[model samples]
Target: MEKIILASSSPRRKEILNRFNLNPLIVEAKIEEKKSYNESPEQVAMALAFEKALWVCNKFNNEEVVIGADTIVVLGNRILGKPKDEEDAFRILSLLNNKEHSVITGISIIRANTNIKIIDYESTLVRFRHLSEEQIKRYINTKEPMDKAGAYGIQGYGEVLVEKIDGCYSNVVGLPLGRLDYLLNKFFNIKIL
Candidate 1:
């Protein structure tokens, strides 16, 4: 088995990988996550994921496979990342109330000692139930929305706000297992399970 490196600090991603029975070396990738003007949500995510993977790849042996990922919530053309503060979280939740949004996650994999690279993205549509200001505030007070895109986490208390979803639930949480499985199989011939 090839040494696997996860170049992210997201607990959600780590948990998802663990659920697949894969344990990876965790390495935080320090990269500036700035969005490019006029870039599509998918492009922004892939770019950030690539940057993270490249950063970690430079620090490890070539025999390792470095994986990086970025996720964002898109409502119309607006992209919602992690909230800067509780106030921001409240505002994001307000906008998402009773609305459908898209969750886009970009994934990148790089061979540790080689120049091999792969990048792809998955998008999931999620609908939020009508939420009162009190409900949003209560959820925000829990602080669960502070660190998640769109001020909500599908696998946590944020699930209460979700009315429906039309794609991979894991993608909305952070990573898409189906997409990750395909990438691993295609590039490393590694199959989950």
Candidate 2:
């Protein structure tokens, strides 16, 4: 099996990969998450992920399979990024209250030694419940949403604020394990289980 390398600093992504008992080398891809003018959210997500993976691969041996991912919360065409402060978190949560939004995640894999590269995106529809002001304030106090997109972490206290989800839950959490498993086997012929 080729060495697996994850190009991200997200502990959530690492935890997701750990579920398969795969201990990949974690490499931080320090790239600016800037979007092209009028770029669709999915496109931006995929591009960011590709940039991260490619950045790491340029330094490591081709025998290492470098994987990178980026996740974003989109409402209509507007992108909701990590909050700058608790007040910003409250504002983001307020905007998402009682509405449906999309969580898009881009995944990229590169193995120059094997001449393999993949870039793709997955989206999940998440609906936030009608949250009272008190509820939002309380959730923010937990400090989970400060670093998460859309001012919420579906895997944390934010779950109570979610009314429903229309797609892969893992995507909202940061990584889509099912699609990743498929890609791993299809591209690298590696199995997680």
- The best candidate by lDDT is 1
**How many clashing residue pairs appear in each of the predictions shown?**
2, 0
List the candidate 2 regions with Cα displacement exceeding 4 Å.
Answer: none
Q: Which ten residues in a row are the worst by lDDT in model 2?
A: 111-120
lDDT of 2 by residue, 34-150 (tens): 878589999999999999999988878657889999999999899999999999999999999999999999999999556789988999999999999999999999999988878
Q: When superposed on Cα atoms, how far off is each prediction in RMSD?
A: 0.9, 1.1
Error of 2 at 47 (Å): 0.3
Each model's lDDT: 0.91, 0.90
Q: Which candidate is the best by TM-score?
A: 1
